[model samples]
Target: MSGREPIVPLVRRFSPTLSPSDDESTDSEAVHPYLFGKNSSGWEVIEEKRRCVIIADAGAGKTHEMLARARYSAERGRYAFFIRIENIREAFASAFDVGDAESFEKWIGSEDDAWFFLDSVDEALLQDPLAFEEAMRAFAARIADARERAYIIISSRSYAWRARTDRQLLDQLLPYESPKANEIGEEEIEEAVQTGMSDPNKLTNSIDVVILDDLDEDDIRMFAAHLGASDIEEMMQEIKKAGLSSLSSRPYDLLGILTKWRSDRQLGGRLGYLKHSIAVQLDGINWTACSIDPSILPEAVGRIAASVILTGKAEIRVPGSANDERGFDPIEVLPDWPRENVVALLDCTLFTDAVYGVVRFRHRDIRELLAAEWFADQLANPERRAEIEAMLIREKYGERILTPRFRPMLPWLVLLDDRIRREVTAIRPEIAVEGGDVASLPVEERRSLFHSIVEQIAEGKDDRGARDNDAIARIAHADLSSDVAALVERHAENDDALFFLGRLVWQGQMTDCLPLLLDIARSRSRGLYARIAATRAVFTTGSKEQRDTLWDSLLEVPNKHA
Candidate 1:
């Protein structure tokens, strides 16, 4: 529905490895025979392979690749069956209900050579793992019994496959079972096992596994060229400087960046890009017929995004009329705005899905970022801020004070609102506050807060050491001199916490905290590792004197521990 053209992604093939939880010895390194042909046709890469399974992160172009492969095969006068795994059960049932393998083959015209591309196995896995397994087994059996007339290809998100103990399900689906005993020999089994086959007795060599690689520098340049961006190199430089390299590596995120860049020419961070992209879309709409004020449209959409994310629903259905009782009405959230106007605003943004009046953010990250923005806006009003704080600190649903999915949003939320930061700090004192008005607080109150946080760290009141580390970085970001000193003094004895603090200071370029880090590096009570970490932090902060002092301290410390 969005006018952007899809980009074909490069992929590499490897032997299927069991998940880390299942097999610790499984090779983590990617084994290859690269799958993408020079001409960008998968058919050329897998012509000799009978079965292939492609796994990738979400939005890494799995669906696009499958479609491209189907097109390429069709151009070569081969029949290709593109089945969305979401509808696999239905598709298989319709074709297989003819009763026997012969009838099924006739129904789908699979008697001739064909490519069966099953897209989004991850969706089926999530929707119903058992049904998915059963369908896959059935399909695999059909191919196995046939006279080798068809090739099967399946795709899934790598995380979905790894999270489920369904390795055997995949094994069963693969067209890799050995031929009849009369047709195969014992020596073949040994060869298969030697070549890293999952099951030696089965013809595992027939299956090829490929993982999609993230976009590299060349890919980014190609994408920029495709977008017809004049200052492509300049845009790439800005993207990296904004800490958006991770986003750029994913096709969908890269598209979002390019879209925003085209309109504004200045790319902010990830959230900023998303926000601006939404703005660009909204600006293109003709709002003359809308009853809602243009200024309030984003707030209304943000509320919908927040609601779905907070409630942990992919989509929320708003009633069409007053008598309808489908769910929470979007109209109720914004009393002044018409429901149609709110829906229109949502439909315009790339981040939201609004079909038949059911609305949700398109991606979890988009929902969380918008939700954070919504909370930031609400915090501007004192009453609304109190309500949000109350909701955050207490359980709104069974055993969930806040959804685990919302945890990543906390840092951004606090960064956007000083009041929310202070409240979060009060509730979880060991957590960090970024950009809070700590400098304006009364001296004794500031000291009391800092001391309490240090005591919490000393006693290990919060076992989530990562949160403490984030807090330390946040404090450094705020440049709270006293707070930094207190944290160093209290956490000096804990190597893990000290290392995290040092790394955060170094990464954040918190030069003001360099002196405090130097003191820790020179402290006799600290261990060698913690001292070394602090010394590294001092050196990274560009203080020559502190670096020299750290060198002296490192030498004076015991050599055995070093």
Candidate 2:
């Protein structure tokens, strides 16, 4: 037979009640008994209380192994804090919105005498660099100071780079062996056969425990069976184009070939478009093409868009009136633009929208695309490069949006700014104001301006849920802008605003607001609050339609109170 080594099969015992859905092994029923360290070397490692880091590339069974260990510890009555950092950050931030810092700290540090599994630290660290560093250091400090015993295990992509002890241990454990120099020829095999005949049991001790098995041609065919026809075609093309036909069959090489094909359309015609249009604008150039440094990417985008965002030109304008009369000045001709000496500025207002990621293109595609092309050429256009360089100033330092919380807000800002600039110019004649400067006016004056704008907007339109919240807040209560009452009109027949106002009324212990509530119940849709609130408010007002609408909204709330 062929001289392949045998694998030492270890018995893998598992909990009898485990199901496939519990693949992450979080549930007690899903714990595998065989995988527990008590039955294997894993037990010794954990018992030593030595810091351990398991290093593996993506899809290398890291999560499964980590989950098994966590479940094992938890089964023995130990608390386990399985913190998916991304989820924790989102949860903590939301909690902070309605609570305080102490509440957030308590939530994260809830579990006592626990084994903490901080999984996917790479994603956690990358998303919020500052928060990750602070949290990690703080956690280490907390665990150190804890009164009870707590085991902390952190899984991170950077473990290989940062865990010096683990690296050294792994290096020391590696076995180096080579075939004996004298056992090379056919005579040696004959001599070994005779020796084995004399001592048949000798073969047992000579076998290598871990052998690297080479994939034979038939094994490659079996792998091809795992891939669909399209993937096979793509793989073949990648191998041919990369000129790695001889080595492409290796599993790691095969994966890399697929990734490159997906990332770049260099070889495949059906590779598809990049998500953003700007990706097309920078065609054939590397993402790092400008060599400006990634540290400056966020700041560069921010500074370039800052003028557009604040000036009102960047806001989403209602159709037409794309001219400067609406404050849409093309910044290409503007003076004092830094980096002006390094590149030619395209002559168009850099209109941006939040599509296919944060897209920033000129409103007129033809003009913007032309500018994008010309600006790209500046790298090699020796003549204009210096001028472009002079146009953009080098700021001391800077950094990086979403949700009403903070995220998604940047896109809203871009959209709102554009809309405001355009509408202000169009409505300038209606209001005798100095330009479109809302901040320049006194607080009361601004409030007056907001009221006029809202009244003008609501004059003839059917009262739908669409109300200008900021305007309403400015008009009603400037100091309490974040409160819902600040956004509704003192008098409007919109059910949504009324329902929101109902809660405020409820809080104030006032029932005299029924007239306004009655007007809203008759004119618009209903059931924006809990059933009891809606029912109580409607019955108190004595309206048939309001009670019926309350019934409908009750159906919408799952598990609603009677």
Query: How does residue 50 of candidate 2 score in lDDT?
Result: 25
Off by over 4 Å in 1: 6-53, 67-158, 172-176, 180-201, 205-209, 259-266, 286-292, 307-364, 375-562
Residue 210's lDDT in candidate 2: 11
**Winner by lDDT:** 1
Each model's lDDT: 0.57, 0.34
Cα misplacement distance, residue 308 of candidate 2 (Å): 20
lDDT of 2 by residue, 332-400 (tens): 333343433112212112332221112223322222223323333442467975563333212233410
Q: What is the lDDT of residue 122 in candidate 1?
A: 48
Candidate 2 CA-lDDT value: 0.34
For 292-325, candidate 1 gives per-residue lDDT tens digits of: 5568657766787676556544445544633232
Model number with the top TM-score: 1
List TM-score per model, in order.
0.54, 0.25
